[model samples]
Every structure is written in C-alpha cells, then in structure tokens.
Target chain A: MRSGAAVLVEALRQEKVDLLFAYPGGSVIPIFDALYDAPDIKLILPRHEQGGGHMADGYARACGRVGVVIATSGPGATNLVTALATANFDSVPLVAITGQVKTKLIGNDAFQEADITGITRPVTKHNFLVRNVDELGHCLTAAFHIARTGRPGPVLVDIPVDVSMAKTDVPLPTEVHLAGYRPHVEGNLRQIRIAAEAINQAQRPVIYAGGGIIISGASDLLRQLAEKSNCPVTTTLMGLGCFPGRSPLSLGMLGMHGTFYANYAIMESDLVVALGARFDDRITGDVTKFAPGARIIHVDIDPASISKNIKVDIPVVGDARLVLEKLVELVHFVERRDWLARIEGWKKKHPLTYSSGGLRPQYVIEQLDEAAPDDAIICTEVGQNQMWTAQYYKFKIPRTFVSSGGLGTMGYGLPAAIGAQLACPGRRVIDVAGDGSIQMNIQELATAVQNKLPVVVCILNNGHLGMVRQWQQLFYKSRYSGTILEGNPDFVKLAEAYGALGRRVTEAKDVRGALDEALASGRTYVLDFVVEPEENVFPMVPAGEAIDRMIGGMT
Target chain B: MTESKQVISAVVENRPGVLAHISGLFASRGYNIDSLAVGETENPLYSRITVVARGDEAILEQIRKQLAKVIDVIRVTELSGQNFVERDLMLIKVNAPAAKRGEILELAEVFEGKIVDIGVKHIMIEISGPEQKIEAFVELVRPYGIHELVRTGRVAMLRGVSGRPARAAESGEEKKSKN
Candidate 1:
C-alpha cells in the first residue's frame, strides 16, 4: 500500500529536492514520520511556520532554484501567506506543501482545517489539493514545474492527512505535460538583432540590470557585456548582487533611496537597455522626466514583463543569460571615454557618505559585518537596516544577501536568516534588524535558540519608524505624527528570557566588540545597538518627483 | 459618436463587496465597463478601486464616474486614453465545439491556449492571450455562441509602467491594449 506521506516524499525525491524547511503539526504527523525514515531528503524544523515559508523564499532567491516549504494545515499554512505574497511580488520561485486535516474534512471546518488553497489563490501562481496518494507524483511534478517556470513565483500543494496516511501502489510519473506552461527562453532573433543595432550605434549607452541578472545566473555574461562594451551599469534593489559593488561602472540601488549619480545617469543617458528590471515607482520617481532622452531596449524572460512597466524602443523577449550572450556575439565593444569620465566625475564628486551624529547608524552595520565570521550570511529586516546592509555590506558572492526586495517585507529578515542558516549549515547567519520591524517576527528568536541554530541578530535600535520618519522629515515637515516608536520590549532581557545570549550597546566602540564576541559565541545572540534613531539615509527622492531631486546628500 | 473616458475610484470595505455587487450594478444597468483595477491602497482598512469606462459622451462628468461614487467608494477617476490608462485580464475558451477539433486546436496553438478539459461535445480552453486575440478567437469560434466567459476588469498604470517613468508618449488604445 502506498501511503500519502511516503508518496509525497517519493515525489519530492523524484524532483531532486534534497531539503525541506518546515514545521510539523498534528495534521502532518504521518508526513513527519515518513521524513523521519527518509535518508535522502533532510528536513529542517523551523521555529515558526512563517519562518519555514521565508526560508523557502530565501533559499529560492539565494540559490535561484525552487525553494520548498512544508507546513501543517490551518494556522500552519496561514503563516505561509506572507512569504508567498513576498515571493509573488518579487518573482521568486517557492513550492509550499501544507498538510490538511483530511480530504473528507474539507469544507466542514474540522479542527486544524483551513482552505489554504483558497486563501493562497490570488497570491500564489497556482495551488493544488491532493485527493489521493496516487496523484502525489503528478501533483509534485506539476508543483515544481509551475513554481520554477515563467516569471517564476510561488506554488502551493495542500495534501490531506488521509491522503498522506492512506497507502496505494506507487505509479511514478516519468513525464509531465503542461501544454499551458511553455515559457519562451530562447531570445527572438529579430528583437535581439534590432537591440544589437541600437547598442552598436548608441553614443551614450547604459545597461540597467535587475534581479534577472542574478536569477538567470548570468553575472559572468553581464560582466562580460559591461566590460567588453564598457557600458555603465545601474541596478534596482533586487539587482544589487548582479554587479560587484566595487566595480567602477556599478551605480548602486537606483530608486527612492538610490544614489544621486545613478538616477541622474539614467535620466541623461541616450540609450537605456533594461535587463530584467521592472521600472517600479520607487525607481522611476517622476516617470515623465525619467530617461526622456533615452532610446530604451528591454530584455526579459517573462513575456508579460515586456513593456509591462516601461515603454520599449526595442523589446528582446528572452532569458538574460541567453540574450546577453547573443547580443555580445553580434555586437562589438564600444566605449565613449569622454562619457565614462563624465560619470566618474559625478561619482567622485558625489560619493555616498553618512555623518556620525549623536548616534551613528551606519557604524552599527559595519560593526556587525566586522564581528560576523567569514561566510556569515546576513538576513536584513526591512527598513533602514535593510538598506544600510545593502549599501554597506560586502557580499562577495551570490546567496549572501537574502532579504525581501519586491515586497519590502518588514518581517522577512529574521525568519529568512533562520531559513538560510538551515541551507548553509556551516555559515553564521545574522539578521540585521530594526527594532520596529523586528517585533513582527521576534517570536522566531525562540526558534533560533530552540533549534541550536546560532543566529547573531543585530538590532539597529533606532527608536522610530526610521524610513517613514525620514520621509516625513524631508517631505512632510517633520510633523512627527505616528513615527515615534516607544515602550518596546527590553530586547536584552527578552533574548535572555528566551534562554539566548543578548546585549545592548549604546556606544559605537562597544558595538564592534559586542558583535565580535557574539559571533564568536556559538549560541544564538542578539545585540541591541542603541543607535541614534533620528539619523536618516541621505539622497532621498520625494515620491512622484524626478530622481535628480534627491535631497539631503552633501554632494 | 463622440466618446469620453471616466476615471472612478472607490474605497470598498475589504469584506464581501465582490463580483455580485459589481455585477448587480452592470447587470441592473447596461453600462459597459472598459477597465477596472482593485487593490488595497495606502490604507489596509479599505480597498482603492479605479475604473475607466467608455460611453455616453453627453452625460454629466460627475455622473459618469459616479456609479462607483456610492457610499462604499472613497475616491474616483473615470480615466481614458487621453487622461488615464487601463488594463484588463481575460481567460477565454473558444469553440472546439464538436465539428472542427484539429483546426481549432491549431488556432488555439497560435493564440497560446491550453485545453483544460475535453468533453464529447465541447473542449474548455484556457488562454491568457491578448484581449484582441480573445475577442477575435471568440468571434472566430462564434458560429458556436460562447458557452461561458469571465474577465477580470482592466488595471491601469498611467501611460507609463511606473508613475514617474516617462509617459507612453500616446499610442492607439487598441495597440496599447496589446498587453
């Protein structure tokens, strides 16, 4: 007899998934038992279901593969919602498996039964309900295929308890056919040729690369294009890891908090070739004034993404790796030294810097980075710490920077770090958090301590909703409405309360030492850096305005 | 006939102001909806809705975009090609209605469709192709009056993809409607 749980495990193994980040529950007891005996696929028990989901997301984004998460039905599956939404917005591929009470109990509102499929319908690319163990192979194959293809997003499979327990003769699917799921990977040669000519003739060309560069696993190709053509590159927040932060042509995150030089360069460039970057509102502050002089060429893997956000002069519909390779083949390297010098002048004249006021926030991240051991993965909670880490951290390789970009999910960092640490067992995972946002997923700290996962959580304790507060300061006249955060948990005691190491650092000198010691200690550590909450990230562009109108930078 | 576009924004309580209400409005009156997009706006307490419907050039400017201005609504913009932008989602299944199966499959292939389920009498095709293709395929398959049709109303991004990105520099509504 083929048990549902066994069948599911068999199917996952067939898909070549070696690991599952998950939390067990009453409904999924059978699957848990099956996992206990399974020798091939390792299961990581997340402290929280939300963390499980985020681990999947982080893994997917980090590895550029479909991340898998397993949870029990009802609340267990419900917690996966935020991560699924995060993946959907960011176009990350995740396969979430949730165990239901039983198929018969569906619609009856049985104990621990929630229509997770229905709940996740809009947010997920699609979902499935396994009625029998017999369908496990087909269902899993479809789940992985859907999760990993075309504008890749999250997919859910809700397996009933009975289905997981009931046995049947296994009939593994050797092949799966989805007539609807054909994703066009090869570049349309006509569009490619047209784009090549545009680039071949461009006087002042710029390559605006996005996360697709990393997703396509074509950083080498992107670097080749940039170096060969001497094309200056700008990236969205998602595209941060694509170009080396130290590269000469690299212009840092270009959007609401983007560099002044990056935005100005984009606006003034005669040619803009967008690779996988969605022209988000935060990036295109004032669309009317954005790249007005540019002849735009957009190359993307998703057909829907083509001209979905920005108007295209020449649209190349293909994967970035394939498309970039072809373009490099057809075109010769050409650089305007005069133009490169101009951009360098802008970069040199307007280099990014932060002042160490009464309390320096930038110092906190630096300290955390210094303290963190080599191969330590930093998962950043959204808001100021997230941006600061993105700007300041030296992420030398892929999967190193794991945080929410598309969704700007505030609670993602702590749980995502928990997830990443599970994947890379040897690496020290740190969650650089803002005190305000940390509260959202602070429950996971117990997970970290319980699982014996040594996560060095550095809380940049700025006592306000710092990002929004900055906006209100710059644009809304510092009315200081609801931005002030007060009467929060004593995090030091809180970490100790959870039986973990915790510390509060008020001075800059103490921060590095505290972090270094914490990282050196094997147990989960929480360092609450009492940074001056009033400091703001500079070069802020007011919404609905031109990017060039960035305020607050000395440059 | 002269045509004008209306932009109507609505703030609906997130509970159950679903299709039944929207359908009741359109079914009760013969108002054709050109485009509609609904999402949680700045505040999660309410959903912000923007619809661009075309018709009746002579109606009151306030009245045309006013249907959504009911108590549930907090804002409105009866947008058009000139002032506003709109996009809609369509999942269409044209005739594989018994007689011409293979030929219809070829057409469906051209439109990039999936045959979801097949019956002796009809085949249910799933397609997220262009609206023009949907309309054209529906008309092409119309010797067999369509059995069922459902479309998510249009969501608009003002001219360009991003709000502050350069405006689309104007194109035919039909051409711009390609997405």
Candidate 2:
C-alpha cells in the first residue's frame, strides 16, 4: 500500500528520472512531503516556475535526456506555458508536472483553475489530467514516452490534488500500449536509395544540414557523407556543430546571416542535399528562388518534413545516422575537385567580413569563445547577438551551441543556460542575450542567483532590439516601431537587486574583461556590455529568396 | 490546396474521462470532425478511435500532434501516403419500392451489403468501402433519400506491416522464452 504522492515519486523513479526542477505550492504539499525522503531523485527548487520549465528544457537539450519540471497548479502551471511553447517549438523534451485543484473543485471555477490544459494544448506536445490514482503510473509512463519520442517536445501532466492524495496499490505499468502511435525510426529504403542516387549522380552537390543532425547525433555520419562524396556542406543556425566549421569542405552557415560564399555555393549548386533542415525563410530567403536549379534530396527524421516545401526529388525519412550509414554503404566515393576548387575561389573572393574599426557583435562572440572554458555551452537568445554567435563561435564538440532555431523565440538564453548549468554542473554555461531580449526574462536572474546556479548572462545592451531594428532599417523605412526601450533598467543595479554579481563593459577592449569577471564570479552573474547601436547582422538573403542574392556590408 | 479529406486513427486509453480530453481538445482547437468512431482495442485496457476530416498539410500535422498529446491518447497516426487498410461503414436509405426492390437487392448482394430495415417508402441499407467506393455507392443510392443514419469512423492500418503492439509482444515473448 502506498499514498498517491508516494506512488508519484516511485513512478518517476521507475522511469529513471534523475533530476527535477520544481516550485512548491498549496495544492501539492503531499507530493513535496513524499519528495523529502526520495534522496535518489535530486530536486532543485527554482525561484520561479517559468525558470523551472526553461531549466528543464535546457537540461534536456544539453544532456540529451528528458527534463522534468514540477509546479503547483494555476499560476505555477501558467508561468510554464511560454517555456513549454519554447520547448515545443525547439523540440526539446520536457515534462511539466502541475498540481491541480481537488477533483470536485476542478470545473467549479476553482480559485487556481484557469483551464491550464486548454491554455497549453496548442503549444505542448500533449497534456494529461489524472482522475484516478491507479492511472498515475500509466500517465507518467506516457508523459515520458511522449516527451522523448520522435522530434521530442514538452508534455504536461496535470495531477489533481485529490489524485495525488489518494492511496492506491501503485503497481508500475508493465508496458505502454499505444495503438495509434508508432514513430518511424528506421530509414525508408526506397527513399534512401533515391538519395544515394541523387548524391552519386550530381555534378555540383552540396549538403545543407540543420539542427536535426546535431539532435540525431549524426555529426559523424554527416561528415563522412560530405568527405566521401566530396560535397560542400553548410548548416542552419541550429545546425551548428553538425560539421567542423573549420573543415576545408565546410561552407560555414547558409542563411540571412550566413557566409557569402556559403550562400553563393548553395544557390549555384546543381544538386542540393538538405539533411535534417527545414528550409525556413531565414535560410532560404525567398523560397521561389531558393536553389532553383538544384535537384533537392531532403533527408530528415520526420516524415511530414518531406516535400512539404521545395519539392524534393528524394525524401529519406529516418534517423540521419541510420539513413547516412546505409547511404555510405551503397554509394561509391567520388571527389568533385573542380567544384571544390571553384567554391574555394569564390570563398577567397567574398568572405564573411565586418567593420574592423567599430565595436562589433561578432567581436563579442569571438572574444567570449576565447574567454570561456573550452567547449563550454553557449546558449543564445534571438537577435543580432544570436546571429553573431552562430557566425563567429567555433563549437568543436556536440551540444555546445544551443538556441531558438525553429521558433526564433526571444528571452530563451538566460533560462536555458540556467537549465544547462543544472544539467552539467561542472561544465560552464553562458547565455548570450541582446539587451532587448534579456529584459523579457530578466526576472529569471533571481531564479539563478537564489539557487547559486553558476550561469553567466552576457547582455549585449545595444539599447534597441537588434534584429527587429535591423529589419526596420533595411525594409521598414527606418521607422522604429516599439523596438527601442524607453527607460531601460540599470542592468548592473538589476543584477545586484536579484542578489547576483554584475559588471559593465563600455569600451571595445573591455569585452574580454567583462566576460572574465562574470565567469570568474562563480555565482549567477551579469555582464552588461554596452555595445554600439545601429549594428546589423549581414550577408542577409532577403525574404523568400536564394542565398546568392545576399546583401549586406560583407556581401 | 485542394482540400482532400483525411482519415486519422488514434488509440486512447479505455476510460470514461478519456473522451472528455479528446473531445475537449478538438473543441478547444476549433477542429470539427466529419465522422468519429471509438471502440475498445484488442487490448481491453485501451480503445481505438478513428477520425475523418478535410484539411491541408499544416492542419493535419497540427491535428496529429494534438491528438498524440491527449493524455489518454496512446498513439496517433495520419494515414497519408502509407499503404494502409481503410474502411468506413455508412447506412443509406435507398428508394426501393416493390418494383425496384429486386434491383436494389441485387446491388446489395453484389456489394455484400445488408438491408437492415424497410418501409413502404424507403429501405435502410449499410455499405462500406475504401472511401472512394463508399462515395460511388452513396452516389448510386442517391436516387433515394438518406435518412438519419450513422457511419462508423474511418479505421486504418499500414498496408503490409505489423502494428507496434504486436511487434512489442513478439519481442517480449521471445525474451520470455529465452529466459
């Protein structure tokens, strides 16, 4: 015999859940009491439920494991919605557990009841409401499975107060039997052959990889494919670390903020082999003009990704590793020496360059990379800083570069870095945020400082939302609309207010000084680098266009 | 986008509250179903549901993911290009009086359909097919009025492969025998 709360702990243990980020609440005291004795499960109490959710997502992304977050129902659950949506969009596997109102009080417009499940349905991968204590085991199992399955995302399990208080036998479910759910993990054979045929036959083939390659742990396979086929490779922002950026065959990154040579090669290639990448507007610029002459082979783990855009000649659906292994075995290696030489010449002619005289975002990223511990996790928020980090950071190891790629959500880095820090305590984690994006979730600093989470939030305080302003400057007739901050808080004062250390950097030479001081603080800290205004991420391909049409200072 | 209808099969837990979650999800998302069917699964612990609707690719993806997220929902599958067995049972009232009753009976016999009830004016008949045939049959029976009738929701499976449960069971049995 076990209490409902005890059963919940045991169920989580049975699922091999090792860590949990949580906040206590009125409706869920029983579960907290049960957690006191479960030393096997390490629980880190976060200052805010929103931070807990993000931390969970960061842990999941950093560790390549399921992240668990718990909160009392109502406000606790509501705070987690944005984090859940962020996780859902980025495909990070997170489990958000909330304590619900008592069963009888659930639909009676209970004080804390705001239809949490309804509010989160569109954003979360799935959600559950546990009515019976006996079904808690089943629900827990399904939540983990759903969270960590194909193209993993967040799942919410709303446990009512009574359900967590009632007693039951608490037998662990033997297995899950989901008739409608079967993830296609194995590669499609016909499509795989078609891909191999396309690769072997193409005259000027290039492999455009995405974050899926990194998520699938297919970096080695991707490199082998590129090396063996003598194909040039470029990656999306999220696709960093899938290939060695320093490699001779590497085209760096291809997108709005991609290298000019990379963009040019992708556009001019006769055959484009896109692996684990969605041709987002940022990457493709204008879809109609994207790789118009190239016969495309899109290989991804998700089926719906195939031919959804850019009508693929061959669409291989399966794990990139599994698919690439088969492709390597079937196809003979051939070198496109002429194509490679031509690309190298093009790169030598038009390289990714920035103004050498001014305080540059790229300079900040390069300096941070040099200052931080080797192979440290650099999480970035969306803006000019995010693009600059993507372009400049040299990530040698896998899972080192994390960001909001698919959703382009702002305020992602601070919480994500906190989560990443919790995931790998010994490793350094840094959140690179623009001044505008940082304020969105600046409250999370208290979450970090309260828990002594050694996460560094480096704020590129450019005064205006860098990315939005850049778009306005280029396309919006330079009429700034709600993009600039009126009374920006003294970031240094804000950090001190949150019980965290703070630093300010105003000079071009002080970037290294600010980064070093923040990292050395050995506590939750902020380094407000007051950067130059009117800076823009360059080598941009205008919307719905090809990479060849890149226009910027560098291009 | 030509709005071609789609058949989605969902497996959910067999419980009274499961329907609330599923129906609530569909309602909140403003997704309307053309026909929905729910029945107990081969495993008594669960139930299998099939839904039919018309939507484009993005909507189908949203629906599949949304269904998969429902707590009681065990699995979700959108039967797209995969070779799968699909069927729907529809009851139509044919205009069969004494004179044309023989012809209607012949047609029912050819299609293996049964005429459940008959009146002085109309005959109630049930027919099933792979959507296309069902549409053709309905068109042929259009000479008669379709009275209040219900169609079992679209149920589907991959064309030539074993389902996940069966495969898992076989693996489990293999391990058991080895032990």
On TM-score, the candidate that comes out on top is 2
Off by over 4 Å in 2: B1-52, B55-179
Cα displacement (angstroms), candidate 1, residue A432, comes to: 1.3
Please report how far candidate 1 places residue B78 from its true position, in Å: 25
- In terms of lDDT, model 2 sits at 0.80
Residues B10-116, model 2: lDDT tens digits: 76768666776777777777876787778886767667788886677666666775666454566667776777888888887877778888877887877778889
lDDT of 1 at A532: 88
Q: Write the per-residue lDDT of candidate 1 for residues A1-555, one digit (tens) a residue.
A: 778787778778877888888798988899889988987887877778887888788777766778899999999999899989998888888999999987787889899888787678657776777887888878788888877775688989899988888887868676676422445678889889988888888888888988888777878888888887888888887887678777998887788788778888888899998998878888888777889899999988765565544667798767888899898877777868888888898898887778865557787776666666545777888898888887677555555778888788888988888777767778888888999889988888877787788888888898899998987887799999998888989999999998899999898778778877888888899988888878888777878998888787654
Assess each model's interface with DockQ, reporting 2 decimals per model: 0.03, 0.14
Error of 1 at A511 (Å): 3.0
Q: Each candidate's fnat, in order?
A: 0.00, 0.14
lDDT of 1 at A380: 88
